[model samples]
Target chain A: MQHALILIGVLIAGMGLSVEAGLLGPLGEQVGHLSATLSIFMVGALLLSLALVFTPNRQLGTLFKQPRWLLTGGILGPVYVIVLTLATPLVGVGMTMVGILCGQVAASVAIDHFGWLGSEQRRVDGYRVGALAMILAALWLM
Target chain B: MLLPFIFLILLAGGAVLAAQSSINGRLGAKTGVIESAWLTFIMGAVLTFLLMFFFEPAHEATLFSVPKWQLTGALFGVVYMLAIVFAVPRVGTAAATVAVISGQLLMSLLIDHFGWLDNTVRPLDGSRYLAMVLLIGAIGLIYLSHQQRHRRMVNQPG
Candidate 1:
């Protein structure tokens, strides 16, 4: 039951992403693509800072001392969005979306299987593969 | 070679997204979601600003030059970051990632069909409908398997 709710919540978040993409497309035309992306991060950071002031941040000393590799998340987020924006024109949206969906599922499965990055191990078995195949087929149809 | 390279980058980009979600989720669990989100955004904001400043060519229209409504798109990103940070810890990365993709596909189709936000109308067809159904099925399968594994872990005796 709890899992179901989380799934729905993420799904809705995904919808918001589509809306973001739509809004950014025209903005990108006006103010350069990378600049548009910068706007997103700046705005997000600004909002999160406001949120922190109200909520109070957790211990900062602990965060800084953690593994340096963990900080890569900040870089990864922008890289992914920028690459997708760049690739869409070259490869077409359908193909680009397929590549992204495939990569995400494959990486997610690998992460779960190998227990990388502190996630629990979930094996890459026929069941998982079947789900992946469905996703691929779905993408292909789109 | 160039085509393959672009595809490779796209794949890497996608992989990075999953990794980011998983990593950020762990960060959220440790430092609080807002704190972790703030860290990534601050870092990302700085890095992208450099990229924009040094690499991006000058344009006729600036952010201020454009209609103010366009800038609101940035707010949705906050929604995505917050959602992923909160979801990943509870539901594991694969499930959350797939669910987000499913949502994207569904919503994009709607936007295309309706020509919302000035996107060209790409009328929905049978294949699009089928694609949505298959995606839903995929989500259902992933969730069920995830539940089974979770239950097994909970029931295991020490």
Candidate 2:
């Protein structure tokens, strides 16, 4: 029951993210995409800090000790948001999402196959391959 | 071979996002989810500031004049990440991702149809609806694949 409730939260999180994507594109239009991304992060960083007041586990040193590759997740956000803002006006949000999702699913397959970034390896079996094919077909249809 | 540079850019966006999840998951395991999120947000904010300062300095004098709702993007972003952080542990990551993408598609359809946020009006035609439906089906396939792998492992005696 707890798990089911968590899944519901995940779904709402998805909805919130979609709303963010929509709002951010226009915010980018008012400001620049990169600037808008920066603003969002700046604000998000501040808001996320409030979380620590409750959890209160200061590990700034541990964060600094991580290898460079693990830290790249920070940089990836602007790349995704910047491109999203730029592409939305050109391709429209619908196709832009399709294309992004295609890339995401494809990358996920490779990541899972190789167990990159410390995930458990899952071999690329027939079911996995078929899923990819279906996703590609879905993208094309979109 | 329809290789549009635009699509490629978006593709890269998705790939980086998937990679971020893996990296962030490891970081979360160590520092706790919200703590790691705070660190990543700091990193992202710092990097974006440097990039924006150097390469793209758009005028923000209008920022104060803009409606308050335009500012909610940041809040929504935080909520989204918090939800994912909380949800991924209970539900599998793939399922979480599918749920996110489903919400994105449905919302995108509504936004595009109404031209919300000044987007060009794109009617929700048959192809668009079919695509959404097919994507949902694809999500089922992903779950089935995971189940198959699980069953195979169970059948094999240690």
Candidate 3:
């Protein structure tokens, strides 16, 4: 029951990306692609900051001391976007997306198998591979 | 020559991305979802601004030059960020990541077929229909695996 809801939540989040991509293109065209990309983070930061201010008991400072590497998430976010932008024009969006999806599945499986980044160990067996194969094949067609 | 290298980089970048989601999900479960999200956005904002200053070429229009409504698009990012942070802790990173990808591909096909939001019209064909079927099959398989796991755990003793 709980897992289903989480699945829905991530799905909605994924759908939001599609919408964001739609908006981002025109915004990029208007403000310049890079600047528009900046605006996403800027605006999101501002909004989230306002949200954090109102919410009580934020442990922001505590997070800094946990492990420096954990903070790489922030850095990775922008780097992924920049790399995608660079890859898109050169390889075409279809091929670029296929590459990313392939990477995502491989990395996810490895991370799960090794329990990297504190994720629980979940072995990739025939079932997982079959599902992933379907996803990759679908990605190729799309 | 360079193309393979670029593709390799993309693959690495994609790996780090899944890593990033898992890391942020850990942070979210610890520091709070909004806090984790805020940190990433602030850090991203600063980094992108620096890149813009040093590397990005000048363009004809600025953010203010565009329609005000267009800016709301960034909010969707907040949704995506928060969703990953919230979902990853409950569901494993692999499940959450694939689910998100499934959602993205599903909606993207819709957008392409309809030509919504000023995108080029690319009507769906047979392969596209098959893609949707296979994509759903993938999601279903994942869900079934989760169900099997849950049943196994339930049957086991503490």
Give Cα-based local distance difference scores for all models.
0.86, 0.73, 0.86
Candidate 2 lDDT at B35 equals: 70
Q: Point out where model 1 deviates above 4 Å.
A: none
Per-residue lDDT over B1-158 for candidate 3, one digit per residue giving the tens place of the 0 to 100 score? 88899889889888978998999999888889998999999988999999888888777878888777788877999999999999888778888888889988999999999998888999999999999999788877777878877787899955
Candidate 3 residue runs with Cα over 4 Å from true position: none
- In order of appearance, the predictions have TM-scores of 0.95, 0.82, 0.95
Please compute DockQ, using alpha carbons, for every candidate against the native two-chain complex.
0.78, 0.59, 0.79
Question: Taking the tens digit of each residue's C-alpha lDDT, what string does model 2 give over B5-84?
Answer: 89998899998887776677667666667876887788899989888889886576455677878877888788777666
Q: Model 2: residues >4 Å from true position, as ranges?
A: A1-9, A56-61, A84-98, B1-9, B85-96, B113-123
The alpha-carbon RMSD over the true interface for every model, in angstroms, is 1.3, 2.9, 1.2
Worst 10 residues of 2 chain B by lDDT: B86-95
Best candidate (score: DockQ): 3
For A1-142, candidate 1 gives per-residue lDDT tens digits of 9889889999999999999988987898789988898888998899888887888545666678778887778988778878977898898877787788788888988888898999867776665777888889888898
